[model samples]
Target: MDHLTALENKSIFIIREAYFRFRNIAMLWSVGKDSTTLLWLVRKAFFGVVPFPVIHIDTTYKFPEMYRFRDEYAKKWGLNLIVGRNEGQVEAGMGPGKGTKLDCCNELKTNALKQIIEKNGFKALLLGIRRDEHGIRAKERVFSPRDENFKWDYENQPAELWDQYKSTAAEDNHFRVHPILHMTELDIWKYMKKENIPLTELYVSKNGKRYRSIGCAPCCSPIDSTASNVDEIIAELESTHTSERAGRAQDKEDAYTMQKLRSLGYM
Candidate 1:
């Protein structure tokens, strides 16, 4: 099999395993290319139907196009969409502009996700995190554990060799299953093009700029790119030395910001 096919098969297997092993599970959908590809993989795993709820952590700061795409695809794809939000913080005018980016993210994203998981009693969460995205994420295992507080213990992690992933966690702890932990940025674009996957228009270039990585409008900036289509995007990614998250402000605020955020359960 080709590389993309191999990645797809591995992801499908991991998704199936998570479904079979966990009693209560959900998939986090950030409405980005990586997560959307993960959703497609879930469909392929379950024979064209996703078997679990698709969760989105809505911070109310996301781009309007993201909200539109989320709702439109939820309807079109027949997804079991569950939207979670830190409504209290949003109502209090707490945002990236009003506070530190780390504080904003912890409140709007991490805390919101914690509340949803606790309320819904989700024992396992299938996230669309790729190891190649960031230095912090590169340390993640295929099946990572989170405490009841939703904190990731980076100091200790389980081993996964020969596709033998350890899914066991304490009764109170939850597992974060990374289905596409192995896919690179280039692989994602290529997969989307090959599969004809639908994506938010924000990814395509507008006036010679495009969002390589989608996030809240307040903290995310568009990169300089003319790659409006998938083919051009793949080519650009092949030659660019820039990080995938160069547009995200929080990551740039501190050298250890991403690590701190992930440890605090910032997904």
Candidate 2:
């Protein structure tokens, strides 16, 4: 098989394994390239049908285009999309503008996700986090476990070699399956283009500016770029020196900001 086929096969196998092992599981869709790619993989895994619900934590500050794209695609594809939000915090006038990036992420994104997981009793979450995304993500396993408090134990991650992944975990520990951990950013865009996957328009250049990463609208900024299409984006990633997460404000506030937020159950 070619590289793309091999990646798809591995992801399909992992998704099936997670479905068979976990009683209650769901997939998290951030409406970004990675998660959207994973969403396509899920449909492929189950013969063009996704059995689990796709979760999206709406911070209420996301780019307007994100919601529009999300709703449009979800309906078009017949997706079981579950949107979660912390209405209480939003009503209390809480947002990124009121406090530090860490604090804002905690209230707007992390806490909202935790509540959704608990409310739905999801025993496993399939995330599209890749090892190449960052140093912290590099330490994650194909099937990592998190405690009831959503604390990721990086030191105690399970081992997987030659396609054998460990999917079982204790009662209070939830499994996190990373199907595309080994795929690079280039591989994702290639697969998306090859599969003709629908994506948000925000990634396309708008008046010489385009977002490299999508997050809370107030916190995520666009990088200076001229890439207007998938082909141009692929070329940009090949020559770009900036990190993929550089456009993310929370990541730049401190070296350990991601680790700290993730430790508190942030995705």
Candidate 3:
């Protein structure tokens, strides 16, 4: 098999494994390229239909296009879309406007995720996170565990040698299954192009800039790029020296910001 096909097959296998292992599992869809690619893999793995619900943590600060693309695709694909949010926090003026980026993310994203997981009684969460995206995410296992409090015990991570993933989690702890953890940013763009996946228009160039990694609108910025389409994005990624999340403000807040966030159960 070719390199891309191999990656696709591996991800598909992981998805199927997670589906059969956890009775109440859901996939987190951020509506970004990586997560969207994961969504495609779900359809492929389940014969053109996604069996589990797709969760979206709405921070209420997302770009307008994100919501549009999300609504459009959920209907187009007939997805079991479940929107998660920290409604109390959002009502109390909790956002990037009132505090540090770290605080905003902790409340808006991490806490929101925790709330949904508990409320929905989800035993496992399928994430599209890749080790290549950020330094902290690199420490993740294929089947990572988080306590009921949503704290990630990175130091005591379970080993997964030779595809033998430890799917079992302790009582009150849920697993964070990362099927695409081995895939890179370039791999995602290339696969999207190869599969002709419908992506958010925000990734394409507007004027002389384009979003390399998308998040909440206030904290995310576009990089200087002329890549207007999937093929151009793949070409640009080949020679680009920039970090994928270079435009993300939360990661720049402090050196251990992401580590701390993930430890506190941040996605």
The global C-alpha lDDT for each of the candidates, from Candidate 1 onward, is: 0.91, 0.87, 0.91
* Clash count for each candidate, listed in order shown: 0, 0, 0
Superior candidate under TM-score, 2 versus 3: 3
The alpha-carbon deviation from the true structure for residue 2 of candidate 1, after best TM-score superposition, in angstroms, is: 1.0
Q: Model 2: which residue pairs collide?
A: none
**Candidate 1 Cα errors over 4 Å, as ranges:** 249-267
lDDT of 1 by residue, 54-134 (tens): 999999989999999999999988999999998899899989888788899999999999999989999899999999988
- What lDDT is obtained when candidate 1 is compared to the true structure? 0.91
lDDT of 2 by residue, 1-267 (tens): 999999989888888889888858999999998999999999998888889999998989888999998999889778999998988888887887787767878887888888898888898899998888898998888888899878998888777778677876787778889888888888998888899988898898999999988988887889898999998999999999888888884555665886788899986
**What stretches of model 3 exceed 4 Å from their correct place?**
249-267
In model 3, the Cα lDDT at residue 39 comes to 97
TM-scores of all predicted structures: 0.93, 0.91, 0.92
Kindly list the per-residue Cα lDDT of model 3 for residues 65-144, writing each as its tens digit.
Answer: 99999999999999999999999999999988798877999999999998888888998999999999888998999999
Please identify which of the two predictions, 2 or 3, would achieve the higher lDDT against the true structure. 3
